[model samples]
Target: MSAKSRKKNKYNFLMRMRPVLRWVLRLRSTPKAIAGGLGLGTFIAFTPTMGIQLILAVLGATFFNLNRPAAVIPVWITNPITVAPIYTFNYWLGRHIWEGPPLTEVSRQFLEIGRTMARLSFWDIKDQIIAVLSMGRDVLIPLVIGSLAIGLITGILVYLFSYRLLCIFLFRRGKKRLLNNN
Candidate 1:
């Protein structure tokens, strides 16, 4: 993209994020609370838990004394558009980290699953179901492991960055406005 278009895109992205930023700023909570809540939400979003993420984030934020709204906002990161890619990358990373199953084995399991689904039900063959479940175990273990690793690192980075930004844009600006009004 051209420099001008890139700038416009950047501006548009910021505009899209404006509502969340406004919500953050409107809260009377401490900067740490807001940042921690945002960080907690971000961390929860990266996990394999799809439906319960929002609830988890809220519970975590409440337990940890973080801002609830800030905690819930980042959970939207794992919506339909993003869930597949994020989980796929995490699964890939997990496979590398723990070396779950051979690629050929995974590929074979998928093909077998497809064939079973197409012809008869997977429940039709108990042995086949067992094999698929075992294969699933191999896949699931690594994905969870990798997602936790990524989430921890990302959550920490987000906390630090959000804290710094809140300090700069919120507190510093408020102080200036107060002084100007005096």
Candidate 2:
């Protein structure tokens, strides 16, 4: 596609998304609830669970008494294009913080185990599964720890910022409507 066409498509897509953005920003839920929901969704997105972020976000929102839409939508921050980089960074941060084995060593051992699993007889499924889970545990433990720390910090900051912004925006909007009615 031509550069101009690509740009046009981008613009069109953004235009189409405008109403959705407006609705989210102007949701009738209390600012604190909306902000909390967004914070919860963002926290879930920081974790390594690629497929279940939305479910986690919704569950968190429901349990925490936050806005569902706000919670669910922010999880999209970790999309297909961004997942690899984000997860890689999270893993690196995890290793640094939690004292895991070196990435290279873990990767090499994982590959060796993978090859062994492939050579195993189909009847050895339990052993193969155990090997896989062992490698996964080595990686996942640190990652989960780091993600929890980062997600909590990020969630709090996002909540504070969004809460203030939402409060100001809603206050102004109410005043504007009141003026219009006067």
Candidate 3:
């Protein structure tokens, strides 16, 4: 398809999703539960796992007594559209927190492996594993540490903010109901 059509479709999809996002934010549930769920879901989102966020969120919510729907839904924040930037930021943050070999070194090793794979000269499996491990050695540690730090901070902040927002919403709704009854 043409680039113009792709852009138009993406824009239209985003427009359609806006209302759904509003509905999610306005979801009617207890303040504690919704906030807890938000915190849990957000925490899981920051972790390295991309494929099983829903399952992780559900299990975390269940284990933590958070709202199931609330917890599971927000994990969509890490979809393909946002994953690269998010992970890049997380990796940067992790590097700041803990020292690791430079990304340049890591990238060089990764490219070497790619070149080997492309040539298909029948490199030993051990060499491939070593190349991968070297790549991971520099990236993984920082990513994990940074993700944990970002997740914990963001989750706590979201929980607090969601709790207050829900409290206000419920209070206003209750006041309106009472006024109507009068």
**lDDT to native, each model:** 0.78, 0.76, 0.74
TM-scores of the candidates in the order shown: 0.77, 0.71, 0.70
- Judged by whole-model lDDT over C-alpha atoms, candidate 1 comes out at 0.78
Ranking by TM-score: 1, 2, 3
Best by lDDT: 1
Clashing pairs in 2: none
Candidate number with greatest TM-score: 1
Pairwise TM-score winner, candidates 2 and 3: 2
What's the residue-level lDDT of 150 in candidate 2?
76
What is the C-alpha RMSD, rounded to one decimal, of candidate 3?
8.6
Q: Which runs of model 2 end up more than 4 angstroms from their true locations? A: 1-20, 104-135
Q: Candidate 3, which ten residues in sequence have the lowest lDDT sum? A: 116-125
Off by over 4 Å in 3: 1-22, 25-28, 104-135
lDDT score, candidate 3:
0.74
